[model samples]
Target: MPTTPLLSKYPEFGRARVYLFGLTAGCVTGVDFVASSMIGIAGAHIQGGVNAAPEEYLWAITVYAAAAVVANLVLGRIGTRITFRRYVLLSLLVFCTGALLCASANNISELVLARAVQGLGGGGLFAAARIIAQLVSEPNERLPIFVGFGLGSFTLTALAPWVSAELALSLGWRAIFLVQALVTVPLFAMVLTLFPRRREAPTTAQMGTLGWPAALAFGFGALLLLHGIEDFRLARIGLSGGETLALIVGAGLLAFALHWLHRHPDPWLDLRRLGSRRYLVGLGFYSLYYLISGGWNYLMPQFLQGGLGFNFQTTGMVLSLAGVVGLVGVMAHTFNFRRVFRRRRVIVIGFAVFAVAAALMSISAMPGASIAVLMPPMMLQSLTTALIMVQVASMTYLDFEPEDFVHAYQLKNIMREIATALGTGMTSQWLQTDRAIARNDLVGRINTFDLQTLAPELPRTSEVLARLSLQIDQQATLIACDHLFITLAGICIAAAGVVLYQRALA
Candidate 1:
């Protein structure tokens, strides 16, 4: 039997064992962020020239995200069997291997495959941290630790893109993934040494605990949600037959998945406790609220680049500022969530602020806009999202029975993963389509008559076409971005109402 420490040395962590556990948890968070950053850098570099189609390189992101969905949903049961520490080590190895593969890949397809491999392994990081943090800490003491994990995760994500970009630029794209492998290797070894071994428990549910239906729900739901968003966006530019099929398939799958959860006795989703009413509402609000939040986060960089025409450094600076403000918000809410503000109230306020911030952002994207116009929305939205996330961490578990901790945690985790993926995917897809449609519309409207053929009354058709294309690209981008604000605002409003209703119940 592994010896249990009498007391946690870190107090917050509970003992030497727990502190080491936290370090491992931190690695999990850090590594996942690193994987994402590496891929982002690779994608950015590949898409650097205008001649490259941004969509072609985006496979790196989509494939990784798909892997995360599949792994996150399936790995819960795996943890029951393998033990969290062993799982962490295995996940790290897989991630490192994928990084190495990505580093060596010569074409976009190879890079995407490598990214998928990394995502498959990297999926365990966040879920495992949630479980381990719970396992290592006293029930009352878990929030701060989880918050710390969240902070580390966000901070790494915040800084990583820039760091990876710089590394890729300096050493070439392959080096970005290589750097991830190098950094994680030493930490992985240290973590294995300090972490305690898992105790075998025969009674625990296996990986197939929820059965295939639940698994299908999770996997297909993610695909559907993501694809649905893609379709919606593509609709603006007029969908291709394939894209339209994808949209329909994705929505149908998601709806069926959710329906199965609701109706089936042993449902795919653990919908049993959703009867709590508070949990259901809270979780729902969380999904919708984060959907908007994810969209805003996804769109911010594009806004900076396409609308404001800022360089990477300036974009990083803006993102960094948002991250810092968000960090402060998280800290503020964590300390205040219990004593002063109730969970629902805090979430509602967060949504209200988000709505306002999103609205501000929409206005900032207007034609002939200045950089200063963006600051207010950027700062406010970031801070607002941070506060909501903190409150969500606390509120999600507020009503959870001690025995139901694993189930409750897993449920929320799934919701967040699906929500963010679907939300961001859809937002991006729509933005792309909208931009394309607007460009096409503008191009169609431009007078194309040859000057000589028009009785000397019109400009040369080719020159006019060139000027129109440039104007269309820029103006269309602005217009599409403006529409994102509407989506953001509507989501915020719906979330606010949900939060209010949940607060009343709470």
Candidate 2:
């Protein structure tokens, strides 16, 4: 069959074309962000809907990420082979079909399978969108474009939980899945109309050698690594109190995968050229950001609801407040930012501010603390999120050649997904362990003699004893969280220090 030649030279888009590209970019990123983030927010509801336990339901999220990583590897080739336009269209079809299946799922198995399918398509969509975004603008002009992208995506991220919760409560949990499916229809039409159709591949562009062996090895290695981490966290696969078997095995597999990618001719991922010191620094900062963001995200909800005894609705409201305030601040700062502050300075401040917020929360959180105490720090942390996001986006790929944009984009996002999971998993593991230890230490201090002194409202009775136990549990959880938040503050400081150390991000 005949097709147009591949785009050897990039076009300088006009004002209208720029706006069209921005719109498409927003839709492309927005759908994936909302759907993926919202699915996470509504996980408990979905779990209940499918009658799955916590561990079982988690596979839905895990599988989605793994599938996406695999999809990213494939799409970088497929986009060039089939033309980005056609590949994206087919990806959208796969995404919608998976969404529909997810909505109709009757069991955990069905839902997990659907999520994997959805992730495959979403991964392709994201890689293509990012590459398009990169190609459309020169490096010097990308900050504003990135700020624009961050505004919509982060705003949607902030809203996804509230929206998902509302939908689940009012329209049933299936509404979450339905939104993903329905939203793609208009997006499909928009992409078809707006995306350039002249970039069909010529015969010379084919990936003549399939890298399936290395690709599968990399994918499996990633899954094993994830499973190993999860197993260690759950205390399931450890032996002799040494490094866990799964982890050791996973590490070996990953080493082999990397070796293969390094040595294999026509490897699926030719990553040798992309690993400059500057690029590696960018990747490090990305992991730090994800760790902080994901860890806090996992912790804050529990702190609000469990530690402070706020209801689910109240927790959502507080989070929404933080999101809105952050969005407003980010928008105000975006236009005049270049004039007001240097990128390096802004990145430093972003991490520094998060450290401040974490420290504030570390000290202020208590069983009797009011929302006012939590709101300021939450808002501060949320506001800096956009700062780090915008700065990182504009700078991460500064060293990559135009030809490497597709692979570079995929690698960046792939690391981001992994770091996110690690952040949540590591925090959850520590919190649970610390909470139990705190609870035990607190329990050991309680006795009939100390009960009246600790709480004068309680009498020496079984019912009052139960109340005291509840109070102790609350106090213990808060103690664990307070300790954890302080540790996070130290990490944020280290993150800021790294930003200050790196000179290339500017």
Candidate 3:
């Protein structure tokens, strides 16, 4: 690759450079939010349009997540090897292509494949944005940019449902992808103009140590594990034969991958680094945070739309309040709170807030619950999520050497994707099982004799029975949601204990 002379020059945080950098960060993060938030709304359209089964819609997310996890690691390294500017531009082009494909997709399988491509590109955007931030700004100057990035991302995430719903209502779900494809054009132009191209060629040794084999193995292992979890969840109670076999194979592949990492001189991931107790503890806290937050993100939309009988527009409006509050929270932390509070203390406080919010959410899952009942928990959870994310990212990298920062970044991104998938999978499994139990219990109370006794008023008609059945299902779902929220509260409390224990040991 020809090197641009501009590549070696660092910006001195000029107004124009800062504005462009912020725009780039916002654009990158916005892509992620748009993709993630679309899943809750677009899944229905994809299912109906493609005639897909309920379980099959999950592939739209799972395949994307798996692809993104692998791409995040691989592309992060590739960017270093090739040059961040070229790699990001290529990724943007690929993302646009994927979005176009998604817009044109006529079936579920095509959509899933397109999403995988999109995820690959999306992962690069995420990795490259951070790399650019590191390259252009001094350490002290980077914090505000990151704060802005978080606000942009969270705002998009909160508003995505509404944007998507309106697009789908007015034009169609395909419009969402079309819009994504169109928006990337200006972003592509900005990257070409603003981002500096690489000047130096990567060393032969650097190129040789790319670890393609380990990367492939790890990616496959992760995909299999995630697929197995999805399979287990869809099976309702116990793992099906296929799910069991898939899990076993996935575990075996992961073990093999670990062994390869241990033995390889230049492994893709530095498994040896796990020996650091601080790193391990940091990962534990990070995973726990994602487990709770991911589950909340996945389940809340359904709870609002299904349990509370809110339409997509109403649900989006209600959820958008969290984003508003979260932006405020991020600003507060960035400007004032972070200066006063230590990272560990901030994290612990965030976890406590999350636990309380989760408990409140559990209590708010009743039949006649109003949007007012949901607001406090939603606001608190969003605020705490912002607090935790910023602190965790800071704390996790505090001990990492410069050379190890890439590895740590890759590890964190991979774990984040995996944790999110697991969170959604576990919540789905719990909801299914709990709903079944609740439904059975509810049904058990109503017998033929009870129906006969109520026939005078209820008429025992099929319409009445159908309505009764729908109510039962809704009630069961609400109870199941409550149970999931309470479980998350417990998890948050346990995570707090983990944080405190690690602090004590330190």
Candidate 4:
């Protein structure tokens, strides 16, 4: 069937049209923020309330991210066949239903399953929103729409932790899902009514090229990779059996999957686009940006709530400032600083600032440090996130032809999902290992036999010992957080140097 002009179906470009476009942007951006950030805010609840171990808690994030990676790659092509409107509506239904399932989940396993379901819909929302943006705005006029989307998305993300904290505290974590379900209902109605209807039937070629095999292979490979990481972490710490076998198995599977994708005539993802040097470098920077940002977001909540003894509301408020700063940074892009600086320069500056922010965060991880000490670094990190995210994305797609734009978007989304999962997983693994080491070192220093030592001052009662043990655990966690931040800072600084060196070589 012939393609329909999807853009022509909407009302004229005016206030009403802008409002609809804005709503679609908000929905797409909001779902991702809420889904990604909630894992951090609710990390404690999921671990303690659900009795899940640290590694197990990671599944809540990994499963969702992995599902999203697959969905983003597959759904775009599927949209071409089913029509954007029908595909979006179906996705919304799936999203809402998943939220309901999440709200009713009684265990971690159920919650993880529901999250996967939700990710499928969330991925569609992201792709559909981009499609709508493409259809509604001319290329020249699209920048403002993107800025507006960034502002709205970050604003929603900024408020999400506070809202999630309030709900989790007042009504329990399940309320977060309930609220998501309720909010999506009206959005669903709006989408159904306002979105353009499909007029064209899919061609035989479109119907036959679903790429399910590639998507399945990709997802399974990602899962195995994460599972292998988990096993490695456990084995290194002597917490479980060695993961060499799992690692080998996962590498083999991933290799097989890549080979399959390369051989497929119409692959879900066009790997050929990665051949561009600019695209590859930008892709590298983008992945690193998410690696740092995602890990920090996940780790910060644990530090504040678990290590520093902050209440949920207080932690939410503190972290929410980053969102506010992020909004400001997004707005800063409107000034067209790119006119004065090369994209490479802007990227290097962003990463440099990120490194500084990470260093500040490391210093703030000391025991008994005030919340005030953490605020500046957090805000700076958020600012740099907005800067790097927008610029790197623009640079990545800057040279692509119109035909390659879709593939570029797909590849970016896939990298983003994988990067986020790796960030959260790696940070969690590092924290778990570092904390164990710190705790052991602290315990070893206690020297109960030495009457002159600090341990002799404490009473020998079980209550006293328990309290002292808790204090030690808290301090150990703080030290571990410090180590993680310093490592992240080193990574950012090194990345900045690499970017600069690449510019020189170019």
Candidate 5:
């Protein structure tokens, strides 16, 4: 809340240009994160706008997310080739262009293409900002920047969703882009004026042209794998022949990309620099964290609205209130107890909280649960996200030296995109599959003759039958939701164990 903490340690508090720059970069990153979350949460509204099928809406989200992941390849290697000034200006151009196109899209195809272009631009901004911060600041001087950046970024990341939801639902899906515009435009202007135009001599350490082959394989391979998983049917064999082929091809390409990166002296993504069990463990947790968060981000609405029969207005209010609660709790944790627990302990505690929240949801997420009963888990989940997020970002790189920052940073960003996209997709796929199973299972228990004897419905009309079917659908869906939450609880508990296993942190 106070600006004083950021400037207190800086000698040049009179100017504080670096502090401002770091804060701006943090805002840019926040905007990007907000955009990613919005795609998942707002997919239904956006789908209606473009008349896209559920899968097509998913494809639209994936194209943007996939392109964002692809941006990592260039971000890691193109550091010296691209000037900071040029990168900022060019990226903002593409980013804003994509936003405009998204706002005006007439169909799903046009929207996906625009999102891809925008993702490439939005994706680079994060890695690029972190790179510049590392390049410009000394280790001793970096804490304030990190703190300020984290607070500013995570603050926006927490609240912007509520804000975006208000705008998109009240105005239209197009109104969501206004959030991007507000952040990116100011960032662009700041860079244009504040950043020095003089091009410094490039450093020669491990610089090279963009590795197109490696980038394509790594990014596209990931996209393919995600597509196969997201689109695969869950009945019977769980996948058709084409889906099976997609899964195999995608896995092969990813394996090949990893092999190539290991062998190549100057890989595009430089994942080899980060070859350690600790780092890998951290990456796995990071992916899982985002997946859980994103999956819930997609699922909570279904549980509340579709299952419990809440109106849209009530659901939105509860969600927005939950966001506010999360934001406040995040502030408290960030300020008062940020150092009270070690990163590993904090992570364990956070996931434990996640387990608690998910368990609560599972038990209480019944057909007629009250908003008051549902509100606690929603708020607690939000708190878990902020608490865990603060830990993972720093813990992942705590062991790496300064030189390895770029590679590690880019990889983590890549994981964030991939994880969130896959989280939403996989959760959606599971919901449908589980709902169908739940329907079949519920139907098996229902005796038509017993129902007829019990109620006789006062009539044998088509309307009565349809209403009975609808009730069954709602009850079945709620059963599926209960299963989903229990599974999430199990994952949270297991993740707590994984955090405890990291001896490096211990």
Candidate 6:
């Protein structure tokens, strides 16, 4: 908990101090990696296997995301009322409690309730980290802090799958949550000992309260709308009458939530910041980047393990290689993002590489392909995402007021969370739908009656169709996945255009 001598004695630390600050940022990011990936375990647990319905399992992700959105909005306001140090420590406590609860959960529903608690903590960890970085450093020193946070997130993300797998195997998935709880203790202690508290605005009650009704309504509304969008895609392909009705209801709730937000005096989130040209453009790029990036995160595991049938270790190795490459790329650009690449140019180029990596992923799923053949493309993809993340976030707040940093940072996190939820959720659904349609279509064309009537004769049509079904399903899933990459690419390109327009305005 002791402050580095440099930070205590100097208003702005030197290079060593800055790097240490980055390391601190990374530690905070580690918390996020643990929380974010825990949901995957929750989903896997509920389905009782890896192959559980991707659509049904998606709520594990969406619910966590919904929690984050509420946290970002709510915590941003809460932080304004207290010291950054106190807020972070409190947030960590909430997170640790959630982790412990998740570890002890008896069922998926309990696990999700635990995750909602975890999400509250997880969301605060990210937003609070950004806010703390802003407070600790001078303007010129922020990039290093941002870099440190990025390195931490990417490293944990890269390592988490392998680590989670091991823990899940040896100790059960619950152990992952327990480990997070243990890790937070030292972090919590460090904050209390070192970080000095500061005065802030009035209490929440004095700041014109956002009541529970408005808060829950706003949260549920956003969740339902997002759920509707996710469910709509599934409904288009398959789903019974009940499922379709659920989707419609979700959409309606989302609409009502928006109307409520418009009418309410004390809505939980401040949507006014979203009106800024810079904030909008920045969020646009962030959402696009994550949409593309999230697709890779969600599908790559399936590509590595499900399609190629690589063992867990092998799949982890493949992703680990990409993560290492991404870390190197981020470190290489750490000192000078503005100097090395213009923001607009970096995003465009990054998206181009991401698209290429995504395309190669589809090819990697081709029958009989070795994963080693796909490593180069995956590394390139990781490198691109690494660069884009830091650059865009730093640029997003480039010209904003100091007071606006929390708002901008929270919005950035919200967009990334939602984009990941939507992208991963929708794509997983697409894969399932495509496979089902292919399987049913292949079955329909087979002459089961003729094969039965023929008795001992070779069931040529059935035999061919069985093999054909597997091939068609696999191929269709890959093709649909490939198209998603192209769609993400187009989204990124549009984001680039928005950033360019904002740049012109600047």
* Per-candidate total of colliding backbone pairs: 7, 0, 0, 0, 0, 0
Q: What is the C-alpha RMSD of each candidate to the true structure, in Å?
A: 5.3, 4.8, 4.1, 4.1, 3.6, 4.9
* Tens digits of per-residue lDDT for model 3, 409-446: 77777777777767775665567677888899989999
Q: Give one digit per residue, the lDDT tens place, for model 5 in 158-178.
A: 665566568776898888775
Q: How many Å off is the CA of 347 in candidate 1?
A: 1.4
The C-alpha stretches of model 1 lying farther than 4 A from their native spots are 1-20, 33-44, 47-59, 194-196, 199-221, 234-270, 366-371, 441-472
Tell me each candidate's TM-score: 0.81, 0.86, 0.90, 0.90, 0.88, 0.83
As for candidate 6, its clashing pairs are none
TM-score of 4: 0.90
Q: How does residue 443 of candidate 3 score in lDDT?
A: 94
Which of candidates 1 and 2 reaches a greater lDDT? 2
Q: Which structure is stronger by lDDT: 3 or 4?
A: 4
Candidate 6 C-alpha lDDT tens digits along 1-506 = 74434343354456665655566656776787667754552335435632335555666677778887777767766776666666788888988998898788776677668778887887767777778777766675566566766676667766776766667667766777898898889877756654445535566553545445555555676676666666666537576677667667656655666676677675545565456666677677778777767666777766655555566666666777777888788777775555765666776677667766666665565666786688888888888855577666666676677666776777788788788778777767766666567557655765767446644455567776575555656655555555665665566556555556557223
* Shift of residue 166 alpha carbon in model 6, Å: 2.0
Which residue pairs collide in model 4, if any?
A: none
The TM-score of predicted model 5 comes to: 0.88
Off by over 4 Å in 2: 1-17, 105-107, 137-148, 206-210, 234-245, 329-341, 449-470
For residues 1-506, write the lDDT of model 4, one tens digit per residue. Answer: 75433234343445455556565666655777677777777778656666777777778788877778778777768777777667777877787888888888878898889888988877656666676566555665665466656666777788888888888899987888888777777777867765545556767765547667667767767776775564356426443335566566667767877887788887666788667788887888888898888888888987887678788998898888778888788767755644635667777888888889889988787677787788888888888865678788766766776546667777888788888878887888888888889999988887656423646677778987787788888888899898888988999899888988765212
Taken over the whole model, the C-alpha lDDT of each candidate is 0.66, 0.73, 0.73, 0.75, 0.76, 0.67
Highest lDDT: give the candidate number: 5
Candidate 3: count of backbone clashes, pairs at least 3 residues apart or interchain: 0
The parts of candidate 6 lying over 4 Å away from their true place are 1-21, 41-46, 49-53, 194-196, 199-211, 234-268, 441-506
